[model samples]
Target chain A: MPALVVQWIVALVMLVGAFFILLASIGLLRMPDLFLRMSATSKAGTLGAGLLLVGTIVHFWDFSITTRTVATIIFLLLTSPVAAHLIARAAYFDGVPLWEGTRRDDLRGHYHTSTHTLDSVVRPAPDTEIPEMEGDDFPEEG
Target chain B: MMLDVLWSAILVMLSAAFVLAFIRLVRGPRLPDRVIALDLLTIVVMGFIIVYAVRSGQAAFLDVAIILALISFVGTAAFAYYIERRV
Candidate 1:
């Protein structure tokens, strides 16, 4: 590719990635509670870093750089969600407060308060009855 | 020319994010909040290091980025474990 084209692509990708990072930070600041902030940072921060890595690959375009960047990307994708999960679990066990409007927490009834472990017997109740057929009351007109 | 412009623009934005993350780090109501803020700050710093590597045309700095990312995740997970289990 031409130098100008590569530079333009890099600029655009970096711009978008940087914007996501900025948004993550803003969300971190504005969110009401720890869970929401975790959501923002985990998703947006990982995406932004991925985008920036893409930009780096485009700009550098070397054998070693490509390998390292791909490794970094994989590492990021694998770990971020797990990290978020662990943190959220810890927060829940620590009784970190949820946002006011937050309604249904399925885990509330499932987790053992003393042991901090989710119990298997406490599953969510399934929908018992399907809605009655709306238009099936009438027999075939034949 | 375009790369230069993009670099400055992104640098400015990331710096702003860094400052906001710092505020969260400092003004936390709980330990978990502080941990989250530290995680965010580490991510932003990783971004900064990656950007610097790109700007300077250095592949070595990417190693730093990789190490930083891995270490930050481990740190976050360890903190989570600490919060969950005291020992």
Candidate 2:
């Protein structure tokens, strides 16, 4: 490929990556609740970072840089979901209130706060009617 | 010249992102919100580092990006653990 074409590709990739990162931050600021913000930031942030790294690889076109970029992207892909999960689980147990518009909570009655264990038996089967659990069990804030 | 302009534009966008994430960090009502903001901040900074590496033609800075990624994950996990135990 021509040098000019390659430069354009690099620029385009970097621009998109920066755009995603900006979107993620905006979501983080504008989302209504903690879980919603986590969802927005984790996914968008990881993709943005990965794309930025890929742009670096293309710009350099060096074997060592490519290896490092691949490694970094892989590490990011592997760790981001885990980190999001950990933080979400902690937030849930910490009793972070769900948004008022949240329609259903699958873990509502199944989680045992005392033992930090979930009772699988309490999970509603797809075909069965879900028992209406009391919302008063936990505090809800708008 | 075109690449230079694009690079500077990207840098500006990433800086704006950093500031937005920082606002969340400061305005977050709860600990987890703050933690998530910090995590996003770190990721945005990583993007900045990658852009800098490309613009400066310094492959060495890529290593710093990698290290930042690792450290941010560790910090997030530690904060999660603390939150879980505290409550």
lDDT top scorer: 2
Query: CAPRI verdict on model 2?
Result: high
The total of clashing pairs for model 1 equals: 0
Among all windows of 10 consecutive residues in model 2 chain B, the one with the lowest summed lDDT is B48-57
Residues B1-87 of candidate 2: C-alpha lDDT, one tens digit per residue:
877788788888899999999999999999999999999999998998888788778889999999999999999999999999998
Candidate 1 docking classification: medium
**What residue runs in model 1 are displaced by over 4 Å at the alpha carbon?**
A120-142
After the best TM-score superposition of candidate 2, give how far the Cα of residue A69 lies from its true spot, in angstroms.
0.6
How many Å off is the CA of A129 in candidate 1?
Answer: 33
Off by over 4 Å in 2: A122-142
Displacement of residue A51 (Cα, Å) in model 2 is 0.6
The candidate maximizing DockQ is 2
List-wise, what DockQ does each model earn? 0.66, 0.85
C-alpha TM-score for every candidate: 0.87, 0.89
lDDT of 1 by residue, A74-126 (tens): 99999999999998998887777677666545565576656676786764335
**What is the alpha-carbon interface RMSD for each candidate?**
1.4, 0.7
Per-chain TM-score of candidate 1, chain B: 0.91
lDDT of 1 at A19: 90
lDDT per residue as tens, model 2, A26-69: 99999998999998999999999998998888988989889989
